[model samples]
Target: MYGHRKNISDVRTPDRFSYPPSPSPSSYSTSSGKSTSGRSRVRGAARSVAGVFVACFTPPEEDTHHHSSSVYGGVSDTFSSTSDFSGASDSTDGRKRGTARGIYGTRNDSTHMKEPGSVKFTIAEIHYATKNFALALKVGQGGFGTVYKGQLQDGTLVAVKRAKKIMYDNSIGGEFQSEIQALSKVEHLNLVKCYGYLQHGEERIIVVEYVPNGTLREHLDCIKGDVLSFASRLDIAIDVAHAITYLHTYTDHPIIHRDIKSSNILLTEKLRAKVADFGFARLAADVESGQTHVSTQVKGTAGYLDPEYLRTYQLTEKSDVYSFGILLVELVTGRRPIEAKRELKERVTARWAMKKFTDGFAISVLDPKLEKSEANGLAIEKILELALQCVHSHRRNRPIMRRCAEVLWNIRKDYKELLD
Candidate 1:
């Protein structure tokens, strides 16, 4: 789905010492055992950022407290491990919940959903909605799972996401439940709503409100003549920025969306963006008021991964900023993040556009399908400038999500002022 598949060279699997992975698309089973991708020999500076999550988590075979487990990749069996969600925030000072304005603010009032297993739907109801997972209802597929269009008894449409393995009874269930917990307490206009979930026999199904329009990636690369206007693309970018701002600043604690990419963003009839797939979301610790980052093994799609985070293994909210920067480049250029069929210099859109942008040809990156005008051209320049800052090699140079949203909102306002 990323693009035309070609033979990719082996880069080696991840390192086990990085710590056991939890349930979610990024999960890795303890059975996989050991990792040595040449990256392990990274210079001494790399050890300084080698992550702290390992202290709180250990592979089941090595620890007496854990049960054996596996997810799509697999997860840790212990509840106290990173496999389960738990962080302390004692108070909510900003952001609201369940609405657009102050959603992350709801932390002060959240009921604190402690049990994901409790939020369940019946399998029969799932069958009634998805018509028993008929091929016609299928909408998407990937390493994580398959998504299908479905309708509930009340006639409300929904999206049903099923596990890759038909019978994912035990270890994989960790990820199933982890996703539920992540989606349980929070609600936001820019977030995909989780209606509930169902489990029968070996099958685990997640039910979320259906957004009819399709993924942002599909809209960006449509084969038909239908083209997304420059204004429309700008709006989509703002919507996603707002959603990430909500996640980072609101909630009981900051939630790091390990994977932030165009394909994960779903669009509605209005083409509004909604962030989905929280299986890899992790709670930012509230142990200290000044905590700037969490140490965790690198886990995310290749093209969008943050270079700083990848080298140091010190995860931070800015990592998402770097990935969002890639999404911005995609929106402007209409190119896949990692297109290999092209020349090496042109393969990575970020690098290609960055070089062009530095040479003062940033305008060349705008999607040709979009109409041009003086006002829009100025707006596009500002967007590209912000994007370059986001993809900065050093995390300190990247703008925070809230600031990014505010900047995009100002760019939107420029359109109205210019019209007047």
Candidate 2:
């Protein structure tokens, strides 16, 4: 499980130590000067052997413990009080000899180096990457916290959401953890990808993949003269509907995106819709009775909220459907979910549009920018019918996500055929 690969070039040992030629026998002289060369030769051989033994047995000055064994005899054991040869090896062979110092550095070899990829970004690095929480790079702000745009050294862009403590209450901390858990598991073309997270000190930052096209709300508000085409609007609606379907029924536990509005829906360069902001999402229980819906202060945009769910606080997948119904109205009518300036009865556009559809005045609610071409008008009617079904007052009456997806897909198919 734990191992490392070392470079062969970095590991090298000294070549074999050649001993000087033994001194000639004639070079040594004793008491007898006459032809004692034979005796001198014998003495000279003894001296050479003694020199080799001394060099091998001598311990380094730093060594404090001693134990030795001869490699040649395999039986010779010499113990010295000041030296420890516990890990030393003989290198008489012609092949390379590797020293512990050259391989790993320390004689005791207690410390191990961390692998190359083992060092992840530290808290400080993430802080620096985000410009120490600069205000200018902030992309969005919400109840949870502010999200800032950051770039890594490798030129990859990321959105870092720093969770702000709501009213100094730690209870909201659970929301941050929940968002992390939910986003890490969910992956789809319409869902945003969570890159990673940084929990440092009192701040918790969630890193996510950055999409360039900004929020659907911004695009709708900024682009004035040239409105989104009918086909583009339908395409966006279908994409967002599919995203909600994945969260509600595709996953192991159904997720309720409590907050689904124009601001929460992000767009890619191609205008593909991606669902963002899961701060209010919750997982439904597997067992029927195990599910418990929160009936506290309602949390959603005013006009887009499901009136029944809002009053009762009985949150469910249907609540998201109701919001999507309002979004569809936005796409078709080119209006906000709640237009305060409109007549008091027309406060919630979804409700108003539904009434208009029943009164056979649905065409009046369609955006004027949409051309009156035969194909466009027919497509608009089909989409209006689907949107009306989505905003049904009874949660049970609303179609399931799968059914919604099928309806939208069929609408797209029919519209595309008409254009052809």
Candidate 3:
């Protein structure tokens, strides 16, 4: 329910999600500036990228020679335009064809890939599952289209994302494919699971496991009732961190979740948070060991986007950390990331939380309903401190998601002890 409305257009709208690019030498440089070496390493990475990229079936695209970083310091949000290449797609006569390179380095002629655990439901079956797209079953709305609450023949409940179809438009077609590429390959307790998808004519729908509870954002909203306790918030934090850590470190192919906000964090009936919506996820494989960041356009919710990433487009795992930091602030304060209704300085929760935290008034940012129990006080302060560090200006200063999770885990344990 926390998902955003995604579009197939590149007109700078909310749903026009773009893929992360492997940083080209001309496009990205370190804080120390190593342009000469950076280019040389990326050239090698290109070869490696081609090999793996071939195996991951996505729409194919010719190379995008976007070198727009020369302007605005070193931060180039070049792919923010309609001309942006989606890395894996090409526009020909129109209907985008899915392509793949199989295990033996042999190219497969099949338009669709059929890997184990990768399932495709018939259009008829999906129609029945979604109850013919009944309005009553609509669970959420986004740029992508309406999300429906569905049930399969076996009584398995699912969340079906009915993507907005465009006539002869190629942009959203690629976004839909990129989303499937990442979600189909990776699995983690903290990540949403994609069950299958259906392509019925121009209509595209992705079916995923339906999480019973709403989004973390909904839970945080006071209007939704004071349902989240301090412990629950901490648990959500750890869950998000673990999910991001899994994408960063545990995956065979590391992923960078370009969009990480409370809205993308869904809760199960148990309130276990699962990171959903891989609309902006990027494979971190094409990067060289030394050039860990991917160069992509700055595309994310305003307040959660990393200041460093926005300026540099040098997207790293740290970018996710920055967004997660904002999420932590949300948990701590029960506020939205961007609050236009608030005062000027307090408009951004992260910035507001940081000022308050650094000034030794971090306690002031706590949710009013948290009750300020003596036991959770110190732990809450520690969490706020960690979140402050995560939002540090320099990406280098932020702790990795795993480290963030460990700290939260410890705090949760202590909180549990206090409850006991």
For 92-132, candidate 2 gives per-residue lDDT tens digits of 11111122222112111111112211123557767776888
- What overall lDDT goes with each candidate model? 0.61, 0.56, 0.61
TM-score of each: 0.72, 0.67, 0.72
As a TM-score, model 1 comes out at 0.72
Q: Residue 241 CA error for candidate 2 (Å)?
A: 1.2
lDDT of 3 by residue, 1-420 (tens): 111112212221121222223332123331222244543332322222211111111111333222111100112222222332222212111111123212112221222334412778898888899889898998776555678898888787888888766422554565567678888876667777777787768878788877777778778885344569888888889878878877776655677877787777888778888888776677763333334456565555555667666555566777788788778888989987767798866766665655454344556677887776655555655676566556655566567776787767766776677678
Ten residues in sequence with the least summed lDDT for candidate 2: 67-76
By TM-score, rank the candidates, best first: 3, 1, 2
As for lDDT, the candidate ahead, 2 or 3, is 3
Candidates sorted on lDDT, descending: 1, 3, 2
Clashing pairs in 1: 70-74, 71-74, 95-105, 96-102, 96-103, 96-105, 96-106, 97-106, 104-250
Over 4 Å off, model 2 = 1-121, 165-168, 223-226, 288-297
In model 3, the runs with Cα more than 4 Å from the true position are 1-117, 223-226, 285-290
On lDDT, the candidate that comes out on top is 1
